[model samples]
Each structure stands twice: as structure tokens, then as C-alpha cells.
Target: MSRLLFILALFLNTVYSCEVCEPCECNVIRFRRRFLCTADCSDRDLTSIPGTIPSEVHVIDLSYNDLHSEDLARLKLFTGYLTDLNLSYNNITYLPAQSLSTATQLNVLNLDGNILEKVDSTSFGHLKQLHKLIGIHAKTFEENSFENLEGLNYMSIVFGSQEVSENIFSHLKLKTLHTNFKTAKRIPEKLLNFGIDTLVDIYLDVPNVESLHENTFSGLTILKSVTIQTEMMQTLPSNLFHSGVNDDRKMPVNLVTVMIDGVKSLPRNLFDKQQSLKHLALNNIEDLILPKSESQVDTLDLSGSTLYRVSADWFTGFKNLRFLNMSRTKLVEVNNDTLMPLLSLTVLDLSYNNITNLPDHSIQSSQNTIVAFNVSHNQIRNISSLNI
Candidate 1:
């Protein structure tokens, strides 16, 4: 009887293995008490979508293959069930009008490494539920290319060394935009105005950008985070964060994080309007200018800067600051009252400087709250047991 039971079990296992998604791996997932499958068909050198992949597969990864636009017709089999699809690093150039007409439930799509040059209204018109889009390296986008993506909250795209079309992001309500473009001297004010009501975070990775104007971020009412990285920037406008009175929104501005690297000079009142900013990073500034305005910033980073001395007034408004990183800022000394205003500072990194001594009362005010103090790679040669 035991031998018969073993034979039956073996036969059942063989039958189940034969019905599995082949040339790809499927992992059964129990979501909401339903047994769903996620298929990974990456790096299979597949020219076409495998017919063996079950229609109930919720997530499909067909990256690193030779798939083309014609192969996407197989997505019709999954229809309204597929949630996530990754076809990155493929040779797909053009998306047919009806290619994704049935993918109404697709939430995330990644098409990173394809050389698609044009994106029109029909390419992604049916993806109403798409929340995140990764890697759209398109050159020419029609006016209404993204009008149907009402639910798209995050997008990562390359603008391909051309001027950004203002109408490309017309009706979409994006919350975060991570974009890259070369050859443009500055970001077009009109392009960002499209999502001004909903855009919260904007990361500009333009390497060749030369300058930014005061009205660069004019009307973004609910904007919170802004990180700009450009090597060619010389100076930042003092009112770069100032939202003019022309914007009629009543809600309080909520700008929180600002990181601008590789600039020459920062105006003294550069952050006078960003009172709600918490994390500020101005690394690699040639001539660092400390803002005189009292801010609510908690985490400050001046790494790779060239500040020679720190004054007591610099920390007057930094009472709530906890983490301070001045690493690589060419400082020669810290005055006795330099850090007296930082009542809540807990972590201080003053590494990679030319400081020779720590005065007895240099950090005396922060002795109680200070936890980790790093001064390595400095020219320190004095004995300050109280600060050790």
C-alpha cells in the first residue's frame, strides 16, 4: 500500500511540473486568498512571448531579450489582470495603437534601454492605472502623448539633448519627476507649470545647465523637495525658492529638502523664503555663503565646500538641527561660540579640514545632546578631553 501511494504522488508531481510556465520561472503568490503567479522571463533570448506563460500571471519580466513591438500583442492574453510588466533592454522601437489597449490594470511598466524615438497619443493610452513609468528615452513626443495617464504619479525619462515639449506633461498629475536632459541651458518654466498643482518632488540631473532664474520654481504650491545637479552653474538666484504672490494658493508652502551641488557662489538670503526646509545640502560650492535667515533646517551638509571659518551667528537659527556635516570644508578653526546656538545638535562631522585645535568651549553647549562627533583627517594636534 505504501509503494502504491508513492507511485501516485510521483505521477501527480510530474503532471504539475508539466503545466508550469516553461522557459520562465513562476512563483505562486497568495494575495487576498487567491493563488496568483509571477512570471520572470528575463534573459531568455526570447523573440516572442512564450505561449506557455499562463494568462493569470500577475507580474511579468521580459527584460534583456530580443522582443519587439509585435511581441506585445501577446499581452492581450493577460488583459485586465497583469499589474506589473518589465520589457527593459529590448529592441522595441514602436508601440502599436492597440498593443496595450486591454492592459487596463497595469500599474508599473519599465522600458528603460529601448531606443524608442517617438511617443504619441496611442502608445500608452489604455494604461489608466499606471502609477510609475521607468525609462522612456524618447526624442520626439507628440502634444498629447501622456494625456491618458491620469494615475501616473512617478516618471523617469530622458529628454535626449533636446528642448522639452511643454505639452508633453499637460494633463498628468505627477508627484515625483526624475528627469535628465543635456544641451538645455535651463529648465523651461512652462514645462514644470503643467504639474505645478500636484508636483511635490523634482530632481533635475542636467549636467550642462548653466544657470537658473529666480522664477524657476515659481508656482509649485505644494512643492517639497528639489535637488539640482549641474556642473556648469555659477550662481543661484537669491529668490530661487520664493513662490511669488501671483500664485493664489492659500495652503502654506511645504518646501523641505534642497540639494544643489557644484555652484560657485550662493546668495546670503538664498533660503530666506524656504522657512520649512529641513534638510539642506550645498556641496562643492566654490564660495559658500551662509544664509542669514532663521530657518527650520535640521540636517545641514556643506561637504566639499570652501568655508574658512564658522561664526556663531551661523548656528543661531539652527537650534533644531541634529545632524551637521561640514566634511571637506576647508576650515582652520572652530571658535569657542561657533556651535553655541545649536542646542539640539547630536551628530557633527567635521572631518577632512585643517583645524589644529578644539577650544574648551567650542562644542560645550552641545555636550549633553552630542552623541557622535567625527573629526578624522583633520589637522588636529591639541588635547581637548572635554570634546573627545
Candidate 2:
């Protein structure tokens, strides 16, 4: 059959697209020549990069190894070719200048979960092509630690420095930044200023900032996504995302995701100026109150929460919302006006809940646009209210 022959040809093309390295169980993604070679050396007791790898290998995963300062010299041979390197989750302590002199072509580096207590200023100078770096340290990052990495556009630090100077990111072309200040109480003002006009995605895990300042992200004109997770954030201030004098003020960070593990109540005016918000997810929070917003967010997911009520005002401004996911919650009722404003809702997932009844006209607004209205795993014994 021609159809069977076509499938076979497609399978063979995929199988021969990459080769596996012998003795190391490494994968090689081939181009004109073999390019990306990811050798999963995790849990391997070997302390250094595999010396037997082909020189054309472009990426290497040396994570979870016992690599130390003495083994840093072994990476020099792959300097001209290797574009991405991972040295995270290792027992490495120090990153001296000599350790990086040979990584001439590295573009991305990860040093997360390491004890970098003595990295100096010149330690990153050799990585001229490096534009992204991920390191989580307690005290190694100095005020001007990133002055030499002018090409860096992205960075993720598990425990970033509070003492970082204001202008450390001024000379760089940074576009994305992720930091988890788990122990810190507040995000330093200098941190937001660092991403003035270039940052697109900013992720923070500062649990202690109970109330976010109104001017926290006022000037980040180009940001498209902002995610914040906090267990101790008790009070969320008003106008957290608002329009002001930025060049692109119509929308600031079109999507917002939060993981409030310990938050109990949602503030009413949290998203006053966030009219253009596209997607919002309040994931995995045991106790959460859906914030009453006048802004029309496109998609909203409130999975794994305990909501005892959903008044008509709860769905007032979400008229254009397309997807509503309320799975695995303690919702027992769907009142008539609870979802009346959702004129464009396409998918409604109420699965895995204690929902026992759907009152009259419960889904009347979504009867015209809904493609998937899932009410499985509930005590729903009637569908008389669902006119669709």
C-alpha cells in the first residue's frame, strides 16, 4: 500500500536523524555534521567531562557529577565547539579565572545548586559568547559580578544577591531573568530597574514579599510574561499590574501565573490595570479565593482549590474568557449567573470535583461557543439546565 510505504519512509528519516554515542549512551543530533551531543552524565561518579567525545559535539551535560576545581581544565578541549554546558547540582565550590579560560565558545551555562562562595570577577570573562547563565548561590555574586559578561541576555539564579548594584545589568542586553530569593523578604528595587525595556519574562520566588509595591514593574514595557510564587505573601497590594507612561502601556506582561501555596484570600483590586491579560493560572494552592477583576482575562485556571461560593460578580469582567478549568476543586454548585459573562468560553472543565448540581441556565452563555464542556467525575444527575 502507498500509505504504509509513506509511513515507513517517515519513520526511517527520523531514526537516522541522530546517532548514539558508544560507551557513554550519549545522543547526537545530526546536521551537515553531528551537532548537538547531549551526554547524560548525571549520577556518573566521573568527575570530569568525557574526553573521548567527538570534537564536533555542541552541547554537554556534566551535571550531578563530582566535578571539582581540578577537573575544570579538562573542558578546554571542547571550548571552540561546545555551545551549551551544564555543571549544576555538583559539589563544586570555587570558579576561579583559570577554570573558564578555555570555554571560549560557550553560549549558555548552568551552575545551579552549587556552593559558589569564591567566584571572582574575571571568572566569566573567557565565555565571550555566553548570553545566558543560571547559577544559584548564597554569597558569591558581588556588586559588579556580571560587568564582564556584556553579551548576557538571560540568567536564572536560585538565590540572587540583594547587594547587587543598580548598574550591573545596564551594559548587558538582558531579555529574561529568573531568581528565587527563598530566604529574602523583599525584591530589591534595583532588580526591576535592571530589566527596564529589554526583559520579556521575569520569574521570582520571593515568598516573603507579603505586599507587592505599586511601582514594582511600572517601566518594564517589553515584558510579556511575569510569574511569581510565594508561600508567605499574605497581602497583595492594589494596581500590581497597571497602565502608565510606558511606551507600550496597553498591556504589561500579557500573562501572569502564581503559585500561592499558603495564601488564603485573594485581594479584590489586584489586577485593576491588567486589562489585556491573556492567561492567568492560580495553580496548586490549597486555599485560594478567586480575585474579583474588572479586566477581561482570556483564560483562567483555578485547579486544586476550595471555593465555597462563586457569585455573579466573580465572572463580571471575564466576558471574553475562552477556557475555564476548575478541576480537582471543592466546587459543589454551578449557579446561573456564575458564568453568565463568558460569551467566548470554548472549554469548561469541571472534572474531579464534588459538584452535585447545575442550576437552571448554568451554561446558557457558553451554549453557542463551547466546544468541550466536561462535567465528568461529579454527582451531576441532570443536564436540563445546559441548553446546548
Candidate 3:
């Protein structure tokens, strides 16, 4: 009898100590877990993540929670297999270094809308495997905060009112850095240090920058496109598009697009040595000027700018150009030589301008390649001289 009681007690203990499996409905599930252990819970209204989170769970969504810094620390149990974590739109202010130091397998982390003020270097020291990080709408980072994330590949900084520290991204291997009109002053000089020799695109939305410092974009050798919001700009620096000292040193040999809107004037040599620029948009500009004989731009758009006139030799060196737009500029006259050197010109937009007359030789030189012409909304009394 004594032996029988001992065996029964041992069996009971073993049964109670084993991890229990929980039931989940297939209809309401978003992610599928392999173990289905008691370790994983979603939308449980548990204000805090328990430190005993099952070590086997790989993906965790603590989103839409009121989790603060202290509550986030409770997730220390997930230091092993937690690869993907989303803590967006939470009440967290600061990320604890201890909580992140052990997360070895973490690859993708999203902390988009938290009240974070600064990211300490140690917060990302252990996340060597991290690939994608999104901190779009948070406040700015402290200096050298991103010094430890050298292995990161993809990053996004969308729609925020923060000024990123200069060289804030010097250490990472970023593919995209999307920024809106956040900073009121000039772009931080450190922004040019990000080995742009490998960058594909840089989308800038600084509508308030009136003047860009010369040599502001000196190192973007491999850059493809640059989109700038120019609604509040008055003038563009002469070397706006000259990234390097010489043409051969530029990294982005196949530069594609340059989009700008709402500027007053473009200085001469705006595109000095950029041989690869293809599509250009100068929308909403009030005053516009083309480069001298030494310039080279492929496609140009001057639509929505209040332009008044185009003098002779204004577009002298745009020999490889294809498209040109001068709509809504209030232009009354264009010299005969304005469209002479543009032998490759295809499209011209002269809409919404105060153009009541065209020069007698307006089409004298542009008879062969000119494909489409827009003269709508002009005060033209006759179309006899105009021919496309």
C-alpha cells in the first residue's frame, strides 16, 4: 500500500507540472502559433506583460496597449525567440536597455508612435540581427543614439516634427529614409555623411528651407532620385544638384528624377555636372530660370510657376532634353532662340500664362521634333504663328 501511494503521488505531481495547452478559435486568429502553449496571449487587457512569457513564442503583438516602460520590462522572459515585436501606439516613453539587451533573435521592431525622447546606444547593442526598424512619428533622437545599429538594412522615418541629429544614421546600412517638412532650418550637415554611395533614394520634404548651403549634397554618389518640397523656398543655391567636386566622382551615375515645387528662382548652373537627370518637376514656382551653356538636364517641368518671359539662350545647353512645361507663368513672349537648342524637345506646356502673342519665329526652329504644345488659358488672339 505504501508503494502504491508513492507512485500515485509522483504521477499527480508530474501531471500538474506539465504545461497546459490552450484552445484558440480559428475564426478570430491573425497569426498562427506552433505550440499553442499558455505562454501566448493577445488583447487580454493585461496592462503588463508577464515576465514568464513562454520562451518558445517567436512573434508577439503588444500593440494597442497602455504598456509603459515598467510594463515593457516585464517582457524580459522573451529574450530568446522573440524575433518580431510591435509596440506601436503605446504609452511607453523610454525603452529599457535591459529589456532589449537579451533579445538576440529580434529582427523587425516597430515603435512608431511612442513618446520616446531619446534612444540610448545600449538599447540596440544586442540587436545585431535587426533588419527593419520603424520609428516614424516619435520625437528626435539623442546624439550618437544610433551608433550601435550598424547591421540594420531597412529604416523609415515618416511624418514627424523632430530634427534628427547630424550623422544620426551614420552607422546603419539604411535603404530608405523618408522625411517630411520637419526641420525649419537647413538640413543637418551630417545628413550628407550617410554613405550615399549605396543609397537608392532620398525623399526630402522641407518646404521652409529658403536656401541650401553650397556643397550641401556632396557625397551622394549612388543616389537615384531627390524629391524636395519647395513651396516656401525663394531661391535655390547655384550648386543645388552638384553632389561631388567633379563629374567622374559622382556615385549615382544614372540619376533619374529631381522634383521641386513653389520656388521663385533657380540660379545658373543649378545642374552643373549631373549628366543622368531625367525627369524634373518645377511645379508652383513663381520665377524660373534655366542654366547656361555648360548645363545638361534631360526632362524639365515649369508648370504652375508664374513665369513672365523666356529670353534668348535661356535654355542653351539642354540639348538632350525631351519635355518642357511652362504653364501658368503669365508669359507674354518667348524669344525665337528660346526653343532652338532643344532639338530633342517633344512636349511644351504654356498654359494659364498671360501670353497674348507668340513671336513670328516661335515655331521656326522647333518644327521637326516638337510633339505636343499646350497654349490653353492664354490671351492669344490668333494661332497663325504657332505650329507644333
Instruction: Judging by TM-score against the true structure, name the best candidate.
Output: 1
Give the runs in model 1 whose Cα sits over 4 Å from its true position: 1-19, 31-35, 43-48, 64-71, 243-252
- TM-scores, one per candidate: 0.85, 0.80, 0.62
Cand. 1 TM to true fold: 0.85
Off by over 4 Å in 2: 1-22, 25-28, 31-43, 160-171, 243-264, 283-296, 376-385
Preferred candidate (TM-score higher): 1 or 2: 1
RMSD to truth, every model: 5.3, 7.3, 9.2
Tens digit per residue, CA lDDT, model 1, 217-274? 7678788999988889888776677644564423225789989888888887677666
Clashing pairs in model 3, backbone N/Cα/C closer than 3 A: 221-251, 221-252, 222-252, 307-329, 330-354
The Cα error of candidate 2 at residue 304, in Å, is 3.7
Would you give me the overall lDDT of model 1? 0.82
lDDT of 2 by residue, 52-154 (tens): 6655556777787788866877776664767888888887777767666766778889888787764546768677688889874646456556777877888
Ranking by TM-score: 1, 2, 3
* Model 2 alpha-carbon miss at residue 296, Å: 4.4
- State the local distance difference test value for candidate 3: 0.67
Q: Which has the higher lDDT value, candidate number 1 or candidate number 3?
A: 1
Tell me the whole-model lDDT of each prediction, alpha carbons only.
Answer: 0.82, 0.70, 0.67
